[model samples]
Target: MPRLNETDRCRAVGMIEAGVRHTDVAIQFGVHRNTVDALCRRYQQFGTTRDRPRSGRPRITSNRQDTYIRVVHLRERLRTATLTARNIPGLRRISPRTVRNRLRERGIRPRRPAIRPVLQQRHRVARFA
Candidate 1:
């Protein structure tokens, strides 16, 4: 379910402060009673119902590294992902899958070069004849 916005949170808190029961506030707002209770508690404790900043794992590669990978891939369009990953500095610890993922982010994809049999001079001359 979608989370309530600031306006709705404030209104719910206002209704709770006006002596309305938590269940009644939840019914009026079409939210769960726990949601109303949590919002009221948050308002009482934090003085605001705004979301706090979230923390997560940091990226393995920097923007400069990503650009470098893109540039190298552009210069050597036929290079395999494994070879590309090996050629990149500081990426020796990363796998070919990681290299492909980084390139995928930049809208680049690896593909095999077209295959054709080698044509000798006699074959070309016979074709022209």
Candidate 2:
């Protein structure tokens, strides 16, 4: 499941700060009581709605993709990060990180090796004894 965003986290914090019980917050957000407590603590520390360090697969995309994502911060460009041409416009939405990982997995990087085939002269320089 995707992590909660800033807005939702803020809402959760507001609900908690408003004297809502921790268990109730968990039930509302489909999380554990500990999660609610953590959210509140993080908000107190950062003064913003943020989630604690979540344990899971680390992001595959490097920081390059982060910069690229911001530079190309448009729905169309973001959607086409992988340079894949698809017919179905709204089939599936992938995170910018996913696109970078896919490109890496396919070895479709920006830099490419330079190669040149040497020519062999056979007919013109045929040796006759």
Candidate 3:
């Protein structure tokens, strides 16, 4: 499940503090009753607007400013080329499924409808006048 954003946390807190029932808060937030109860309990315990820690995929591209600059560089370098899963130095062996994800992270993508050759044999051609 996705973690709640600040807006959601604030909304939940505000609604709870406004005397809304936990079940009502859960319905309003589109979360399970237990989640609403837990958020209310957390609010009562912590008395702060800060979100609790959540477990999920760890962050990549820790330096966001540098990562954005690197993405720009990658885009400039790869713009004219057909970027397959191969050819990226550190990503040459990356899986086909993950290639797009890497490209997405780097803000680069191959041109759609990648080039393909069309061949016609002379024997297959019909005689013309």
Candidate 4:
């Protein structure tokens, strides 16, 4: 589920400030009572209901790196994502699946080459004759 937006947060806070019960506020918003309680607690503690900056792992690739991947894939359309991931400078550490996902984000899909049977010289000669 998506997080509540600023408008919704403000409205909920307003209802709380206007003497509405937390349960009532939750019912009105169609959210859980705990959600309302948390929002009110956040308002009381931080003086704002806005979302705080969350800490997590930062991105390994930047905009430039993403563009480089896109361009390389465009230049060599037939190359597998594994090969591209292996050959690109500074991208050797990323897995092939990650590379494929990045390309998918940019609307590029690396397809495997179609398989065809190898024809012997006798078969070729027979077909030509």
- Model 2 pairs in collision: none
* Regions more than 4 Å wrong, model 3: 1-4, 45-85, 90-92, 112-128
Clash numbers, per candidate: 0, 0, 0, 0
- How displaced is residue 93 in candidate 2, in Å? 32
Q: Compared to the true structure, candidate 2 yields what TM-score? A: 0.42
C-alpha lDDT of residue 72 in model 1 = 84
**Better structure of 1 and 2 per lDDT:** 1
Clashes of 2: 0
Q: Between the candidate structures 1 and 4, which one is better when assessed by lDDT?
A: 4
TM values, all candidates: 0.52, 0.42, 0.52, 0.73
Q: After superposition, how far is residue 37 of candidate 4 from its true place, in Å?
A: 0.8
Model 2 — which ten-residue stretch has the worst lDDT?
Answer: 82-91
Each prediction's RMSD over C-alphas, in Å, is: 6.7, 14.3, 5.2, 4.1
Best model number under lDDT? 4
Model 2: lDDT of residue 19: 94
lDDT of 1 by residue, 29-102 (tens): 88899998889888889999897778987777778778877888899898877886677677446667877888
Candidate 1, residue 68: lDDT:
79
lDDT (tens digit, per residue) of candidate 4 on 5-78 = 89999999999999999999888888888998999999999999899998997777777778878998899898
lDDT of 4: 0.84
Q: After superposition, how far is residue 13 of candidate 2 from its true place, in Å?
A: 0.4
Candidate 3: tens digits of C-alpha lDDT, residues 24-128: 877777788887777777878998667768898953323543343345446565443334433444412534444455556666663445576776696568787
Name the lDDT of candidate 2. Answer: 0.62
lDDT of 2 by residue, 1-129 (tens): 446678778888999889999899888878778877888888888897755477999754456544444344343433454343222134354554465555555554422224667667764585776
Question: Alpha-carbon error at 41 in model 3, in Å?
Answer: 2.8
